[model samples]
Target: MTLALAGGALAQDAQKGGTLRIVGTADLDHFDPTSGALVTTNNFLRATQRTLISYHASTDEEERIRPVGDLATEVPQPTNGGLTYTFHLREGAMWNTPGGARQITSTDFERGVKRMCNPALGSAMLTYFVSLIDGMDTFCDGFAEVEPTVEAMKAYIEENDISGITQPDDLTVDITLSETAGDFIYMVSLPTSAPAPIEVLDYMPDGPEYRENFIASGPYTPVDYVPDASLTLARNPAWSAEADPLRAANVDNIEITFGIQPDAAIQQLQAGDADMVYDITIPPAILSLLTATADDKVMTMSAGRTAFLFINTVSDNNGGALKDLRVRQALNYAIDKTALVQQMGGPAMAQPQSGIFGAGVLGYHDFDLYPSEGDAGDPEKARALLAEAGYPDGITLKMPYRNQNNQPEIAQTIQAAMAEAGITLELTPVTASDYYSKFMTNPRNTEEGAWDIAPVGWAPDWVGGAARSVFQPQFTFDGRHQTYNYTDYNNPEANEVAKQAINATTPEEAARLWAQVDELVMADAPVVPYYSEQVVLYRGPAVENFQPYALGGQGDWTNVWLNR
Candidate 1:
């Protein structure tokens, strides 16, 4: 089915005054917008926070994904040779407070941008904006020198105003970028860029106090929150539908129950106990049953997430085998992607991916620099390369994989394929909570050769013109290491191409350059691009206006309402 039609299904007459129930396995990582990076957290934030710009919840894929003004009067056009953006804040956009709603101002927006650089918050998205915004990197550097206290944070923010952001009046905010970025407007639409009141600075960022003292500027406000237990959101009494154009505010309350597994969530959905399965995809075991019995309720689409295996070249494990380019390339050739797709629950769940860019992002092209035999892989070629790399007999490698989300089965499938090419893999399982934050992202683990191969995944930070979003954080390391860039791989030529792509005047020109960079990075084989996935979600029968959001690749909560 076309995405437009599927999105249109949700727009039947909207009903109001029902509690929407949501269930998920894991709790949110952070309630503060600046600190959270997970998409699930972003989904919750959508109801409580308002960015300067945001996409309209629509049925048309392009219109639904494109950025438009939320707090701002409209999406601003870049001036000063694409180096400057001027935003006029919309009047009457207010923050929900204890006494009454307070007007949201340009200072609030500036405060939000400054909070991202706070060392205590440790925002994963800071890297995307640090280099582009004028004097932002310097501000961040100065912030790192201070103690992580509320007093110190307040002093830092008060002493140093971002030179680029200037507010001449209460409503006007002018921003100048260090570099020309065509995608700067899109970056502002992210949750990290959501405005917060200066009063929030009284509490420590990301500390317990901050979460407790959370304020809302959107349609809903968090009334009660217990981590790993439950979260209850009610309509912000101060919020007016006339002021905000994006959210319908159809449901009166949103109740999210934590610690429910995907299978259990599915059961709850089928039994009409739950309205939606939060962020978890439908489990593979019951996919066919739901497809036949409840096809209209199912929604599937490709998000920007790409899953791959990171080959640690810096590690000296297995006689520093991965350090050789031929060995790395052989590892890429060794895996049968076709089999890997089936292990991930058929093409509906995942398709073989050859390059870094996924399907949804611009500049994404289909090409495999390293050719495989009908996506089954060339074991013979892999064996030949292994012999050439001085590992004719066999090479024993240690691999780590996440225990959740059918990853263990995918790891086994890769292990079997690698065995055919004389590569023995020892698999280590890590829990979902610690996999990315503690294990894979820990540079100490890579330096100590804890594991040679680790399965990892990434989704574009934003939707369109996201070539820089995909390549910069994962592939290139300037000086400071990105959390997800575990290998610490840097290529000057590839980096230069990526820069050109970012600076390209037209989208077509940028896409060509990005595709070129993808080919260059793939030749290095720092990672094995296994598969890109299309998530499958199921909504309760009573749920209506369940438009599939392109960013989260799931039903948009802001657009959904209860039919009953």
Candidate 2:
């Protein structure tokens, strides 16, 4: 869907040579592309790094999303029964180096994949590639056994190579997958798959040294960066506009300042102090004012992001109350998604979601297993189920939620609704940074019954055919646990269907199988899917040609030029 703008469009021509200033509430979790999973980090990486394939940063909705080649000459067609892919690197693609610029080769691409398996790095997206690439799982397992040091990491990479990837020449790279993946090309577009220079192997991935001494292979290079402070991007002298088709590089420089709240960032944008708020959703309170005053600058776009509450089925909180399916179903029925939507700033900000997959993702359908009345929830039915599950006198549940954004407000709304169904929710507020990394994902926290339910959100790693993006990471647990699979849930029936869907020849068939998987998961009720959110981005008057990318869920920094 197109971003809904409040005012008239700006001048069409892209004017060059100005510094684009950006402000945001949170700092990037990591600058190392392989280790970071957050969208903000991806936005930062898009400016300073190039992937083999990338989405075009276009003003047109459809053309903007179609994946195109960046470092490669073009999107490769699959060979060898859809199990192999061959990529031809662009002729003039170069990496910014200390001496000068050096040609980026197929070896750099292989190095990028190997970095993903670094144990100390803890790449969240590794699970997506491990099984898909032949011998990758074995590589990761071996890497895990080694000491987490630069010497060990370097030796590991030098000794072994992924059996599936072969660099026939400096420009040609071939990849073979363990199974057929129709959307495998989409995975290469992600930041995790971006090429890394061999020089970076000397420094630990995701460590302080790597973050500071980062090299660039994209249109822009990071000239300066501070962990929680600010970052400055300047044009890469070695980068050729002809080799890359995705980014326009209209702006001469980009300045991103972190730790600015949404309200403050909006004020800066209105006062002409900032060009845009990088990846920060406008607060609902200010969204109304902007809609009336400067509608054209306000952007409300559909993002493939879903907000849900994970029920701790494995945790023995409240004497294993959540272990009962009736109780889990009761929790689902008790949440008033309609009220939750209102609290999150009306229909413009979010739509009530019934399943794990949000709209725009493949396999997403309008089917609610709980069948609430107008999505307002059925508290009476929930109480009956609770009673059936041996909680006739009601139950108490501990919930932890991020303090930032509208999560606190949403939690309060859920608390009010659950109370009506004889469930009292104890809310514990946590900072946005520590919420997921420190508290929710910690196994000790789960074992000690620290929380019974927690507010969480997920966005597909890439844009198209997102069945594996949603299911494998969040639902099914094969041999290893996925980072976002907070509940440690597994269903054999759903897993079997997901495997079939992954191997489906056509998009239509995959979508059908994914829809069935959604039905099965919703029936199990491991998590309460509440709302699919829309991102609201505010741009200053000077910001021109502000087109939002689906993967970044924010305006493309490379395309927009400062008119001022």
TM-score of each: 0.94, 0.95
lDDT of 1 by residue, 21-131 (tens): 998876777788887777667778888888898876655767777888889989888899888899998888898776688889999998899999886766777878888
Compute the lDDT for candidate 2: 0.85
Worst 10 residues of 1 by lDDT: 1-10
lDDT of 2 by residue, 73-156 (tens): 999899999999999999888988777899999999998999998877667788889989988888888988989999999999
CA lDDT, candidate 1, residue 490: 89
Candidate 1 lDDT for residue 403: 74
Off by over 4 Å in 2: 1-12
Clashing pairs in 2: 6-295, 6-296, 7-295, 7-296
